[model samples]
Target: MGPLYCALISQIAIILAFAIIGAGLKYIDDAFDEDRFSKKKAISIAPIIVLIWICLSLFDSVSATILFSILFAVLLTGKIDNLIFKVSTIALISILFLTQMLNLLWIPLVFLTLMGVADEKGNDYVDNHATLKLVEFLFSYRFCMKMGLLSLCILTLLPWLYLLAFLAHDGAYESVRMLGKISVAHQRKKKHTIAISPTVNE
Candidate 1:
């Protein structure tokens, strides 16, 4: 198949994976509680998220795509309500930040922060503390994950951007659908961390 077809299939698979996981979480809310959290439950979604990452990562250069996908997976692992997974994710981010393998460390930092917010919502808890209130004050409700996906999509299209510019055409509009795939991976990973963050008390 061609790049367009490959990209299309990847987008569909990523969307389905995230939708399945989201439905599962909503359907089995109690299963996520401390008493019921198990290795089986915590790990069942790991492979699925990884698969989505792999699928969507196909849109860019192999190394960059895979690296970005790994970052997304690491972030998603934190949503399992397992300390080890969360810590590992944080550690990986820190190492990458220090190593400078991943550009724009602030991107992951902001990504993690947003994940923390979403995870708190997933636990059916809203943090209304003075600090959280301050954070909420600082950030708008425009959905950071969406913003990140938009950035990723735009970045992925850099080559196409130049091509379009050279061609002096309107292919950019045609590229919007590509965002669906990238957004699925980004949003899924973001949601997992967001659902389990600490509540800020005021």
Candidate 2:
């Protein structure tokens, strides 16, 4: 294959890797939240995942780096009470600073961070409150970050490929979340059925 073809393959691989990791993380979080997974196991596994995520970010473009950092920050903020999340966030931040992956232009970083925070808050609000269908759908998938990234791409401030990668990550995250919800519901139904079933005397 030509060099161009090789490079394209590499980029696609990275995007797919990000999608897998995103899905895995979402599954872990959901399992833990539903008490299907123990805190000790999640805590033990978190650091490894954080390290892998940071290493993958290094292979990605600036846009991905900033977006991932914003995502980590949002997660930390939301789960401030969780020890594993706090440690993971601290480790990520420290590594990003040490590696200088976060030394981007301040204006865009600030703008994107604000947009990300707004999206996180809006998503939570829409989850609990009835709202317009369109607004709920947009926030459900955290479209604010996608919209921000697309605007930057249009302005030639960011690469288009990174935006596509971000979408893959978000899509995988959502898919895993939906599957987790379904699994939880199925488990509840099974338990209810067992509870109502009459036992046979041996």
Top candidate on lDDT is: 2
Question: 56-105, model 2: which lDDT tens digit per residue?
Answer: 76766464455564665486447444556667767877777788875454
- Candidate 2's TM-score reads 0.83
lDDT of 2: 0.72
lDDT of each: 0.41, 0.72
- Predicted model with the maximum TM-score: 2
lDDT of 2 at 103: 49
lDDT of 1 by residue, 27-69 (tens): 2233344333344754565445444433433333332332343
How many clashes show up per model?
A: 12, 0
